[model samples]
Target: MIRKLAIIGVGLIGGSMARALREEGVVQEIVGCGRSKPNLERAVELGVIDHYTHDIGEAVRGADLIVLAVPLGAMEATFRAMQDHLADDAVITDVGSVKGSVVEDAVKVFGEAPAFLVPGHPIAGTERSGVEASFPELFRNRRVILTPLDNTDPQALQKVEQAWRHCGADLSYMAVAHHDEVLAATSHLPHMLAYSLVDSLARMKENDEIFRYAAGGFRDFTRIASSNPVMWRDICLANREALGGMLKRFADELHGMADALEKDDAEGLLEIFERAKAARDRYIDGVE
Candidate 1:
């Protein structure tokens, strides 16, 4: 049981976890820390957490469980800020999307603390950010992937797993390196395409009313592009190697698509379409 839980960052993911942990009765006290006092107050008003403060040290000093819910970009700074205050037995984790950089940062900052676990929870998030956007069920029924490195303590890892499971998430494990590579292919690349496509459309938005006529497909594809810029920017830079590789592959495929159109290669087009359709079907089936 978590006697005291400190969540650093009062945004959607952090606030949501605070809400769930409080409701589930896993933690006796829930404290929130953030740069914005209004956001911290909002979380308190929403009853997402039991307490709040802007002092990272005060919030995490005696916490048995500390979660850094800030953007991936702010992770290292938060670690440095809270490191001196973290309890010796406390298990620290974050909800960052990218794992490799997170684990590396944790090792650099918390090297002396063998009980630390820099586990990540990549529950599919909404484009919505900030405290008001959080809901207790955001993590429910979501796939929370935890990337545990080799030096991570098993007990610490299992405690974090229990926390996520208590929040109604399905747990899965992967190496941080492997997780970044896979996400670069699945999540990262799709987000890049979404951003680029949406940016192109935005440039043309002033010229014509294309958005007014766009269908459900366009909305679905552009939804991720609407995500908070700073967060996505951090993710892109943090996992640039894999994302760059994926981008190259995407560009090559784009040229292939252009060629398929120019050559009127119906056989090639049909084959590509069939393969993509089959892949989507498989993914849908798995979810079902």
Candidate 2:
């Protein structure tokens, strides 16, 4: 059990983690730190945290577990702010989508990725933001991937794993670079497509009419476009190399589809649609 849990950003993901751990009676106290006092107050009102502070040092002073849930762009600054104040035995972890960039930030701040620090990403979240949207069940049965360095402290890694398990998450481990690459393809690319498609249509001359006549498929496919833009922007920039490769590959596939359409290649189009349907069906079946 964690004696004291310090959450560096008390937004949706951070607040949800606190709620889950509190529900499991695994954390004695949760102290939230964020730039927004109103949000922190709301977190306190929602019982998501025991207390709140704007100072990173005050938040981590005696906490044994620290969760860096801030955006990827803010990671290095957050790390630099709290490093001097962190307890010697503190187990550090983050929920950043880009593991390699997070590891790089830690190295930049601490001269090396500390043994007690574990980089993690939970493969779950709605197109929602803020502490008010948080719930204890957000991570229930969801996959939480941890990318701990080879020299990471075993006890620290175990503690972080235990915390996520208490949140009802299914934990998995991978190398930092591999995690980034996989997430770029599966998660980041989809978000990019959703945002790009929505923006493209919204800027059209007949955007109002287009949206008014849109079907369920369009709404479902673009739901992620409603997600926090700043967070997604940071993620894309942090994992640019992998995400760029994915975007290029997708563009090539899209060009091929366009060519098929222009040539009236019904067989080619049907083949692509069938393959996609089969793959999606397999995924849905596996998850269900």
Clash count, one per candidate: 0, 0
Worst lDDT window (10 residues) for model 2? Answer: 279-288
Q: Output the number of the lDDT-best candidate.
A: 2
Per-candidate Cα lDDT values, in order, are 0.85, 0.95
Q: How does each model score on TM-score?
A: 0.95, 0.98
* CA lDDT for candidate 2: 0.95
Instruction: List candidate 2 segments past 4 Å from native.
Output: 285-288
lDDT of 2 at 30: 97
How do the residues 1-288 of candidate 2 rate in per-residue lDDT, one tens digit apiece? Answer: 899999999989999999999999988999999999999999999999999999998999999999999999999999999988988889999999999999999999999989999999998888888999999999999999999999899999999999999999999999999999999988899999999999999999999999999999988888889999999999999999999999999999899989999999999999889998999998887876
Q: Write the per-residue lDDT of candidate 1 for residues 83-134, one digit (tens) a residue.
A: 7877888888888888888876766786743457756865667899998998
